[model samples]
Target: MTASVILAPLVPVVVLWVLAGLAVAFVALALWRGLAGWWLRGLTACALLAALANPSLQEEERAPLSDIVLLVVDESSSQRLGDRAAQTAEAVAAIEAKVAGMENTELRVVRFGDGPEDAGSLAMTALAEALSEEPRARVAGAILISDGQVHDMGLVPALPAPLHLLMTGREADWDRRLVVKNAPAFAILGEEVTLTLRIEDQGAAPGAEEADLTITVDGGAPQTYRVPVGQDLDLPVVLPHGGMNVLQFATPAVEGELTERNNAAVVQMNGVRDRLRVLLVSGEPHAGERVWRNLLKSDASVDLVHFTILRPPEKQDGIPVTELSLIAFPTRELFVEKIEEFDLIIFDRYRMRGILPMSYLENVANYVSNGGTVLVAAGPEFGAVDSLWRSPLAEVLPVEPTARVIERAFVPELTDLGRRHPVTEGLEALAPEGGWGRWFRQVEVSPRAGQVVMQGADGRPLLVLDRVGEGRVAVLASDHAWLWGRGFEGGGPQLELLRRLAHWMLKEPELEEEALTATARGQALTITRRTVAEGPPGDVTVTGPDGAEVVLPMPEAGPGKFETVWQAPVVGLYRLEQGDLVRVVAVGPSAPREFEATIATGEVMAEAVAATNGGVLRVEEGAPDIRLVREGRPAAGRGWIGITPRGAYVTEDVSVAPVLPAWAWLLLAAALAVAAWLLEGRRGGRRVSGTA
Candidate 1:
């Protein structure tokens, strides 16, 4: 309870003050002049003022509030490393008991874990929010139980009392991580590129001055190298093939290490070729000759070597052979020597004219068997006796002529296999609306051994493709395919069909008839299977980073592409296989942000503790005692921490009453005035018996 004096003036405060001053001056003047009636007049004025002034005494009742203490717990990814998780659980239970035993104190526990969107520990941000919800004056102290690897320090709240830390983890903890300082997204094939990499040791130092590093490309055997630790090294690499190249770098796990995940890294870089060479052979010039020439010449990456046989060996003119002849390029150099230098060879409207010996044709067949690609565009002469199929090349051709020709307008149809073959799939020639333009001429043929993807008039095999030895072969049954280029009956996808066909023969991975590919988009792995199988291509076998395998079925996506997306469960390299085709891909980063620094330390929260006159103690030394201390004093000691008493309270009830009554003041003033008047009259020797 407490007492206070308050005044309720009858008039305004300013007016009351002026009247009091005037009364004081009047009394002083009368005393100096020695006047008796003046004293009586002063008494009457005082009585009037006393009655106007209203004063009261107030009493209040208050209730005391307990002090609040915050206990922040760090449960983020970094805290789970090593023994920190166990350390945190033990410290949390001990602190809860210690805070509960304290007098006149309230304990608040806030647990924070891994942040959303890969943001690291946000200890300061959580502390600020808890502080805002509680009264500042009632907050006695703030204590944090963490590894001290906080990521948001800018949000640290101002302490009303003291702040302390109960740190987790031991002094002997350490970690090693692999870092790619710089790497290119693209590297040209057959050219060396430089990549900068570093190996670092954090927390406790390792005894070895050098570390063993291993690297692999495209899932091949790893190559080992000895490199000094804590230093950047430049690595020169030459891409082995033209496509996606996966470069994986790893360091062997050390004894007493925090985790091995950070010791490995994965990088993906695209490999591209510099140039491509092609060889084109024509038996004679015809209406469709320019179509093949125009297509090859338009591509800046291709170098075309065109050879046209204008005269047949059987042709015997009356003029001498020397008179009609000009410069000639020897066939021996092209067929027998440097034949592998060409990526693709196209024979258009060609036949056996006896211009070259039988040995040349046999060389061509051997070339096809030795990892070379050949395409044959046949004409009406393919069914004749002098056809190239009758030579040694017969063993390599996908089909044989039936000595018959069909010359009627017929629209080419896509076989079930063509709809699933990458080269012919999704071509305008397979559209639902009447398909492509009609061809007027096609030769009837019996398929020897290959995939017959297209049919001509009377359902005859129009296109056959096959693999002979290590090379590929494709035969088109009609010369009228070029009529589509001229928009003859409304043309077709002449350019698109031929381009994909050429690329397919060149062994483009995207156009392979039988292929398996896995693409990573965040946590989802999209697996696609391309095949010309009679029915469904079946399930795909997936191998994870830890060598675990799972068979997943594929759903049809388009004509030839079957796809399915699987949610990845972990971060590492994933290998996919469908039948004989295999592909390797990575789903997530080998080293995530959480594993970069796994060792526990209190340096991140040291500034906040010191600013609030607090101290940090290791939980390994046992739970600290809870103490009550004054603000601005040291709040921590060897094995104990302190909280300050806020002494906060709220008033419950109040009472106000006047000390003096109005009538008593009036009676006293009247008596004083009457006595002063009688004394003054007697002294002046005047009769005092009359009442006026």
Candidate 2:
């Protein structure tokens, strides 16, 4: 119980002050005048003012509140290095023992590891939250057990008491990290892009002024380079293809460095092509010839070279070749000299007419075997004696044309493989039921180890696609496909079909029929499997950031897409593989923030700790002795950390009563006034008697 005097004034405090001032002035005036009843008047005024002031005795029933200390443990990736983990355990044990033994003290333990987004060493954030949940008056102190590499120092809370840091790493610890200072998110293919990188030494790196770094692209073979440390290195890289390119740069691990995780950095750059060069060879000027020309020329990124064989060399005309407005085709330059310059070559109803020599055709075949792409759009002439099937290019063709042409209106349909193929998977959706236009002709053909993506004229292979050596070949056996371009029977997806077909042949990563792709968003992996099959594919094999592998079954997402979202238990690189496909995805930071500053120091928390009049001591130097200190005093010594005693209390109940009642004060004042009057009269009468 605590007792204190409190005022309960009948009027405002200002009124009381006014009355008291008046009484003081009257007393002073009476004293100056030497009045006989001055003492009696002063006593009556004091009594009246006391009754108006209403002073009371306030007694409070109090219970002592226990002081709370927050103990935070850091388990970020950096904490896993060297003896830091063990050192942290020891510190935690000692703190718990000391706090537990203290009288009327409670330990509120809060452990924060790597955050979901890989935000490193969130000691301050966790401390702020813990402080908010408890009463500020009761929070005696906070003790953080970490490496002191805090990423969110801005969250350092307004501590009501001292905030001490028990740092985890030794002063001699050191680390070396590779930093990609600048890199473009998108790089054009066939153009060299410059990437700025730096090799940095944190704490105590070895005395080597230069370091050797191994750089690899797309998990390919590594190339080593000796580079100067402590400075930026500009690396020029040219993309091999148009797709997501993974570039991994790593430095050799030192004997006593903190960790190699930061020694390596992964950067993903998307590769895009500047232009697509296409060569279109038309046998004759036909209605469908404009379709091929329009498709390739319409794209701003494509460079189109087109030629039409107006007349064969054996044919004679009345006018001279120059006067007849006929230009000789440049077969030698296109086929023999700069054949590899074009990304793709298209042949539209080109029958072997002795125009291109057998040697040129052989060169074309050789080109396909050496990473070239070819597309054959055949008409009825493909089944004739002079068909390209008899040329040297026949060896690279996916199908051999039979000497039969089916002439009947038939709707183009996707084969079982086509329905699952990336090119035609959802083509049917664009054309409603019976919405697709019909083709009037198709050249029958027999496939030789080629995928039939489309069929026409009684289920014969209308479209065949295959890989020849290191290159690709695609064939469309029907020439009436352009009939749909004319809106024949309410036009089909004529442009869409040809566009996807060309892109797929060009080996676009997105158009790969069978592929595995994984995308990461905040440590979660969205794995997608794209294949040309009806039912579900097999379970996808996932290689985690660690080399451990696990198989996950894929679920059907769309017509030919299979996907699953997986939350990774940790942050790192994940490799996903299914069949012949593989993909690498990075979760969170490529170099986790914890490992960024591995050589632990108390520098990060020093300011905050000092702000609360606390200490920043390393655990390696031995746990500091805990002591109690007064508020506003320095709570840290060379070998000791202090906690302030809050002396907080909770009021169980309160009672108040007036020290002196109004009636009592009034009665005492009346008696004093009567006595004063009699005393003054007696003194004056005595004087009168004496004078008489």
Model 2 over residues 600-630: C-alpha lDDT tens digits?
8887778898899998888998878888899
What TM-score, to 2 decimals, does candidate 2 have? Answer: 0.81
Q: Which stretches of candidate 2 lie over 4 Å from their true place?
A: 9-53, 225-231, 279-300, 303-339, 347-369, 379-396, 400-407, 433-435, 443-449, 479-492, 513-590, 668-692
Local distance difference test, each candidate: 0.84, 0.87
CA lDDT, candidate 2, residue 191: 92
State which candidate has the highest lDDT: 2
Error of 1 at 654 (Å): 12
| Model 1: lDDT of residue 621 | 93
Any residue pairs clashing in model 1, and if so which? Answer: none
List, residue by residue over 1-692, the lDDT tens digit for candidate 1: 77798878788888888998998898777666666667676887787676677777888888889889998998987787788889998988998888788777888999998776456788898899899999999999988998888888888888898989899988888888899989898887778999999999988866568999999887789899999999999999898766788899999999888888899888898887566688898988898788889889988988999988877777767767677764464688887786888889898988888776799889889989998899998898888998988999898998989989998899988788888888788775444355678899998889999898888898889989899998999999999878888887677888888898888788776888887888887778999888777667899988888889999999988877889999987878888887777788878677776776777777878888999889999988999998888888899999999888999988899998886788877787888778767766776623344577
Top TM-score prediction, candidate number: 2
